[model samples]
Target: MAEETRTASRARAVALIADVVRWAGIIAAVILVIHVILVAGEANPANGIARTIHNLADALSLGFKDLFNKPADDPKLRTLINYGLAALFWLVVSSVAARLIRRLA
Candidate 1:
């Protein structure tokens, strides 16, 4: 029936959206973690790949980008805390959002 068809279509759409949201969040977390590794490993800042990843991580930081001011003696620590929180936020928020979307739809 048309009603059944519409319901199935709607379900498919919702599923797709949920998948996208989940993947995006996971990707963001991966980027953040990678940035942390690069920084911790003392990768060259002028390198293209490092810069690109740093920019992407910053973009995804969602205001947590500057959550902690760079301390005089421990700048890396600030990066770790801020980026770590952002990554965690994305993971938790995306999971909850995907679940809610699936449930509501």
Candidate 2:
């Protein structure tokens, strides 16, 4: 029936959206981890890979970037907190969005 077909299509659409959201969250988390590692290890910014990771992490962090300012005396702790928060933000947002999409679908 047309109704059944429409329902199936909707379900497929929702599944697709959920996959996208999950992948995006995973990517953001990975970036956050890489950024954390680079900072924690005191990676040389002049290096190509380090610079790339830093730039990508900065781009992904967007609104979450300045949530915590790193103290000059204890930069490691600050990096951990700020990047951890950014990763958490992406995880939560992506999860809630996927749940909502599935519910609506």
Candidate 3:
């Protein structure tokens, strides 16, 4: 019985960790998406909220900054593609990681 209790607790803990990973991925995706919207809409760069989101998105872009360097004339399109791909990457990686983490139980 004691061993069974330990195993159940371990499973629960793993499940919790997996959930955290999944949520984190979802959050990253949301941030990237928001940044894309802000840039495309030409939101005021001076605004504190906009600036913060832009910084976060820049960091999360995962070196996709230039990405192909196409569409140089349209900054909005560039941001949408690069940041959008980064967001999708995080979502996929996090989901796979969560699944692998759950398997540890």
Give the best candidate by TM-score: 3
lDDT of 1 by residue, 1-99 (tens): 999999999999999999999999999999999998898889999999999999999999989988888775776888899999999999999999999
| Per-residue lDDT over 1-105 for candidate 3, one digit per residue giving the tens place of the 0 to 100 score | 999999899989999999999999999999999999999999999999999999998888888766857788988998899999999998999999999999865
Arranged by lDDT, best first: 1, 3, 2
Clashing pairs in 2: none
Which residue runs does candidate 2 get wrong by more than 4 Å?
none
Full-model lDDT for every candidate: 0.94, 0.86, 0.92
Quickly count the clashes in candidate 2: 0
Name the lDDT value of residue 38 in candidate 2: 92
For model 2, residues 1-105, the per-residue Cα lDDT tens digits are: 999999899899999998899779989988998999999999998999999988988888877777777585788778778887888888888988888888887
User: Which stretches of model 1 miss by more than 4 angstroms?
Assistant: none
Least accurate stretch of 10 residues (summed lDDT) in model 1?
70-79
Cα lDDT for residue 98, model 3?
99
